[model samples]
Target: MRNPLSDTIVNIPPSGIRKFFDVVSEMKGAISLGVGEPDFDTPWHIREEGIYSLEKGRTFYTSNSGLKELRQEICHYLKRRQRLEYDPNTEVMVTVGGSEAIDIALRAMLNPGDEVLIPQPSYVSYVPCTVLAGGTPVIIELEEKDEFRLTPEKLLEKITPKTKVLILPFPNNPTGAIMNRTDLEAIAKVIEEKDLFVLSDEIYSELTYSGKHVSIAEISGMRDRTVLINGFSKAYAMTGWRLGYAAAPALILKQMLKIHQFAIMCAPTTSQYAAVDALRNGDEDIARMKKAYDERRRYLLREFRALGMDCFEPYGAFYMFPCIKRFGMTSDEFANRLLQEEKLALVPGTAFGNCGEGYLRVSYAYSLEDLQKAIERIKRFVARLDGEKKC
Candidate 1:
């Protein structure tokens, strides 16, 4: 048989974060901070809604765009929380997860060879999704000095006639970086000037420790060109439910819907029903979970500082990207050694992007107890490395 794989697919590297996660899974006593998943279970009310739907025999496929009630609830949630309004009937469509929304958005917008500006050290999906959609992936390396926030100047340097889409992954995954209204206004200016579209992945929108998350869709004139992707996973702790939605201009949404309708048919019915309840009555759950994550966030930062590690104070998401450059090892080496020597599993920063070479991404999504243990092990590991260097 001939070698028969799509070169594009073959060329895309596997998820770097998952590599260590798999290793940790097999180790008996490993404490993993590798994956980006929320550690909390779905709130009991939300879970009960799903159970209720199943008992009521609502195990049928919804409309290709998803359940009408769920879509409307999504619109309401976005408006109430982010101050961004959308026409649920035409502009919003639910998908399997935020990951699918991202893939389909790229497929809907990108023509062959169109250029997409991706800020580096972002969620792992953006670059590969762009490539698979037949778009050119143009990386804009974000600086740690700037807290990994994408700058308008960096945006300008990357734009060309072929530039079609910019992915704004805020409340960023590996780095926990965020862009405030003023920061987004600058980038919005550049996007508008360049006549580009945006795919704003605000999955961690609810996890910001600072001020509220500002969606680019909320920017003046940006809603028309932005596809806002969010979901129940991070905010509602419904990762297993796999429900997400995309809100964009109806014209763009129509094309995305075509791809989603053909590819996925519809999101799971029970999940949609649960998600409707989540959107309608889940604010308290969000507040409670956000408070927990915030506490863990502060604890990790203080612990990292006390251990003399160069950690950027993350104000969003559950991950901390701490610089491990001083140890004179690659991020991969540092992560591997820590795991081997101390059974602590953290992701290498380079798993996010090449620019992340000298850092490690430690997720604080674990419980405070687990975090405390991991920190103690990490402290010991670093001390040993320091002693070895002195020798």
Candidate 2:
């Protein structure tokens, strides 16, 4: 049989986080802090709306652009929360999730060999999606000393004549680093000078603990240049609902909808109804969940530091990335050893990028009881390593 995979298919690596997660599954009493998902179930109101849709037999496909009402709600939500405006009819498109929105946007915008500036220690999907869309990913390292932020200087250095898009993964995954208005304005200046487009993943926008979330689209000229990507997954505990949407320039959204029309037809009709409710009636639920996560986030950061791992205080999201260099083991080695010896699972930071070396990403989405247990076990594991002088 001839090998059937395309060149693009053959080149992509599997998700690095899944490796430890899979191994941890078979272990007894394994405490996992590796999941990048909210611990809460979708709120009753949201779930009730989805069930109501089903009872009404509204399972038919929506337009490829999704329910107009949902898009309008998204526009309101964005404007109210982030102060970024978009015309719901022309500028917004509902997607299966932020993942599909990302894939479709990249496909619609890029041609073969166009360079995409991606910051390292970001979510894993961006690079692969760029490649699949026939774009080249140029990675810029975001250092811990800089609070894992992508600087304008670093972004400027990576841009070339071929550069087509910049992926800004903020309120960042794995690292939980966020950009304030000052940081964003600096980045906007560079993008304006370079005439670059932006794919801003703001899925964690509502999860910030230290400050209010600021969207790059809020900047004067950047609104038209930025594609705002967000989802019900993180903020509303709707990960399993698989609902997301994008706010983009009308022209780009039109192109993206064409691709979406051919490939996906529409996002789930039932989920769309639920998402409308989520966007409109779910603020209390969001606030409640954010409070719980903030508590857990603080606890885990303290636990990790007390265990002698040097870590950055995450400002948003539910993860902590702590440098593991003192243990003298690569992230992969340390992660594997922790899983095997302590039966605790966390994602190695290297899974995000090479710049993520010497760190491990621990998610605090688990309950306080579970997190406390995992921390104690991890502390003992580290102490044993010291006793054996194995670090």
Per-candidate Cα lDDT values, in order, are: 0.92, 0.92
**Alpha-carbon RMSD, each predicted model:** 0.8, 1.1
lDDT of 2 by residue, 162-210 (tens): 9989999999998999999999999999999989999999999999998
| Segments of candidate 1 deviating more than 4 angstroms | none
lDDT of 2 at 313: 93
Worst 10 residues of 2 by lDDT: 19-28
For model 1, residues 117-235, the per-residue Cα lDDT tens digits are: 99989889999999999999999999989999999888999999999999999989889999999999998988888899999999999989998999999999899999999998999
